[model samples]
Target: MTTPSTLPAAPGPTPAPAPAAVPAPLPRRRRRAPKAPSALLSRAGVTALLALATLYTLLPLTWLLLSSTKSRADLFGTNGFAPGREMHLAENLEQLITADGGVYLRWILNTVAYAGVGALLAAVFGVAAGYAFDKLAFPGKERLFSLVLLGVMVPGTALAIPLFLLAAEAGLVNTFWSVFLPGLVFPFGVYLARVFSASHVPDEVLEAARMDGASEFRAFRTIAFPMLAPGFVTIFLFQFTQIWNSFFLPLVMLSDQDLYPVNLGLYVWYSSALSQGHPEDYLLAVVGSLVAVAPLIAVFLMLQRFWKSGMTAGAVK
Candidate 1:
């Protein structure tokens, strides 16, 4: 009987919460400026220096070429770069060959034989010594190599007198053997051989060869010598140049004009020019100088591959 109806409560509007404070976004970072082309300046400077050095070296050569083209009268009168009215190069070359009963040709042949054979022999001996020093273990190896280093330090010029005496004792003075014998024992060649062998011929490879029943000499001849051929060329070329351009030893050893190398022969011409008051010899001297450099150039051009390969092989492990 007590039924009562409950009434719903009336809704009221609520106040909005105060707006939360908004924070400002941080500024975007600016990227750093790229580096300036400072490297280009360094490269430019190096290029300029190299160019200047090249010019310095080539300027004299140019002068020599132009001067060689001139006649005796034009040589003194004409500016160094100016071409002379008379191109006497052909005449000068003819005169060089025919002059002094063609002694210059003899000098040329003598030089070739001495430099070619001596350098070839030196390479063989040097490589053998170097290989032995690098690969073989023996008593006095270090001591012997040290002695070799000492020999390298001794000036070739200083040894000239002693060499002269030795030649006199052997009665080899005024002979090709005097020059050839001394040129065979290049201390630096041995040094380079040791260096190259240490780098190129791995001990492990030699060990493997030995384990495979290869004798030490057999392993060297079959395996190591082939690897060392590039070094051989290097030593050969070096000794060749040394022997070709050698003046002092020849000067001391040979009294015979026919036995002189290009260097000593040119020196003879130079001295005769001064003494005889013949400036024509001056032109011959220049022409001979140019001719002397040709073979070396040819050698480098022909064997450039071996040299470059040897160097690259050396740098690798």
Candidate 2:
């Protein structure tokens, strides 16, 4: 007990702990200036502008949908934005199908054939060309690709006459081949495929396939094409939509009502309404237009995810 009491002279009164260091005061941040009134006005203006743009786009479709539900009487008499007093959509559809010996159905079938077959072949060619551009080196490759880019710049409308002339020379004008063949040449699809190839596909994998004694075509079929699926879907949808909506080209090439796409057929009906004073033709055209629009919407909805992913994939490293 005594030894414990004498330890280190009682530890020199337990040396008071060093005074706690006070941290220097932090520098204060500068206060933000109040927002200017113009800043608020600018935000409000931008919001208003976007709202107007949205309204502009949706208003027409809204009118189309509402009008499609109405009979001829209601379509012209009732509120443009409001629903019909009685839905005549079924009757309109029946008229659309039965009118002119079921020509509308034939037009639909022709359009589907044109859009589907053309888009399919175009996507295939475009993917092949794009893959060649990205992976396979050849003489005049860059120059050829530049020519393709030039093709993209040339509007389809501008090319309509030239295409018609080419079709005429081949004795294909006014035939399905005339429209189908032109749609198969999608330079933009080639460009998009090249972009997707560069982004999504790796050269190492291709080299590995080649090392495994795979031919270029075999490698593409088995390895590259699968990897480029998103791009292919995107291209197909684009080409399909393009061919589906092609009016000027078909108009320039075809005079036969039997070969008319839905759009052209609807236009024929609409023109007849104006010139021949057929009231029912007007409603038929409206309903036909709505029907024609359905495929586009359906295709977009079904494939939007793939399209979005394909588009975004190219943006990444």
Candidate 3:
């Protein structure tokens, strides 16, 4: 050990006791100033977009409110949103009622009858068809459902000619039945019913009822119907709105103005206003438009509970 030979002299001086490894200056974390658009600006951008949308929707409603106050001359002559000297809404309504043996009221009654009866029948048929498709093991179930889905893609406008022809063959053209019959054949309603039944009516439930010796129809009526109630209301509301706002079908089928729904009736007024030089009918069209929307609003408010409940049920298992 004492005789351990000295190592040959190295070319470079021995490095001083290896300095503790420093972490390569840790890439100087240049304390960057906050990004130009901070979180507050991002939130503000979204709020501004929503505000613009709200203003766009309400702007026309605001104009309608102001327009309702003006007389016929003021409607076209005055600035659109400016209030006029005469508040003629009451006078206009009175005239509207007295016209043609108060045919507008008859139109209103016919609309209610058509929408109510048609929507009820639609709901019933849709529910039955949906229940059968969802619960029953029938031939061509998927194929039939695909057909129904395809029906949704067929524009109602395109079917008007064929429907008119069928109604003509049955001698039902221009009758309330023409409208009612078509409304009852709602493929969309059937689709919705199928979705609701599949989601809400568990097979376990039907099996349990079957085990208890309950008839199939009895099981569905007593057990499945309750769960389907929320879905039914939603379907009813959707169908009702469809029938209520329907213009093209009634326009083609029913020649009688009194049989017209509000939408069709208003359209007639709009057509008349266009041909006739009188602008009074223009005001009527606008006011009638507002009134037509009111029932839909009321229905939505009344049935929003079902809609909300249905959405919740749809999301839950």
Candidate 4:
């Protein structure tokens, strides 16, 4: 009977293969621990400090704007932050342009020439010198660079007297060339260009161009120059700002009011206002100060993207 039962069991459905075991999900990586409260507080503190710094920097600019709106009498009579009884900005500007046979306009044009031309020349020379320093192998390269670093550390103001003397010796004093020539020698710009070239310009690319029979000058002009555009722009802007705001150098070099930059002209007006007791000159100075800053603001607004890109260009690659 048992044998008969065993025989009957043979027809039963075969057991399904045991389902393949699923891999237990990999242990989930432990999530990063939440930042400590102290760390969060530090970040908040840093953000607050930055905000305060920005406010401090902007405070004077705010005062300038408010002061520009006031008449000469209101400028001193009222709170520095308060608006005047009447906005004299338009009238002040009209006086600014028309005063002294439109000498202010001439000063603006002179400033453009000095800053624009000087910055352009500085960019060219700086880029070329930097490229040579970076790519070329020669004796005394490091020493020359060190000398440049020394020059950078030396304030341009400190050299103003010597530069003036040199200009005098060269018979360039009291001329546009005196102010312009000095601005063209931007050691810091060369340093910056060298730093930029070392990173942005690859040796391999230059070698490849050389292999293609492109002369070094041609390669630099067509290839390297475009790659170094950001650096060039940075150098140009720096030199432009320096030349534009330059007071002592131009003051020492230029005797002609026609050759005076806006900064120098403004200074003359401010001095005359203070010394000659002309209250109207004070209003003109304030308005002129506002006008003088506009170009710089416009320049920054226009080139801000380029400036940012240039600053961060080599940071990643």
Candidate topping lDDT: 2
TM agreement with the true structure for every prediction: 0.84, 0.85, 0.83, 0.85
Q: Write the per-residue lDDT of candidate 3 for residues 110-197, one digit (tens) a residue.
A: 8888888899888888888888899999889999999999998898889988999999999999898998888887898889999999
Ranking by lDDT: 2, 4, 1, 3
- The lDDT per prediction is 0.88, 0.92, 0.84, 0.89
For candidate 4, write residues 154-239 as lDDT tens digits: 99899999998898899998888998888889999989999989988999999999999999899899988898998998898898
Q: What is the number of backbone collisions in each predicted candidate, taken in the order shown?
A: 0, 0, 0, 0
Question: Which parts of model 2 are misplaced by more than 4 Å?
Answer: 1-51, 314-317
In candidate 1, what are the lDDT values of residues 1-317, reduced to their tens digit? 99788888788788899999999999999999987777547888779888999999988878878877778889888898899998988887888899899988898899989999889988989998999999898999999999999999998999999999999999999887998799888999999999989988889999999999999889988999899988988999898888888889899999989888988888878787889987878778877877787788788788878978898884655
> Higher lDDT: candidate 2 or 3?
2
Clash list (residue pairs), candidate 1: none
Stretches of candidate 3 off by over 4 Å are: 1-41, 314-317
Decide which is better by lDDT, 2 or 4. Answer: 2
Poorest 10 consecutive residues by lDDT, candidate 3: 32-41
Off-target runs (Cα >4 Å) in candidate 1 are: 1-41, 314-317
Ranked by TM-score, the better of candidates 3 and 4 is 4
In model 4, which residue pairs have backbone atoms overlapping below 3 Å? none
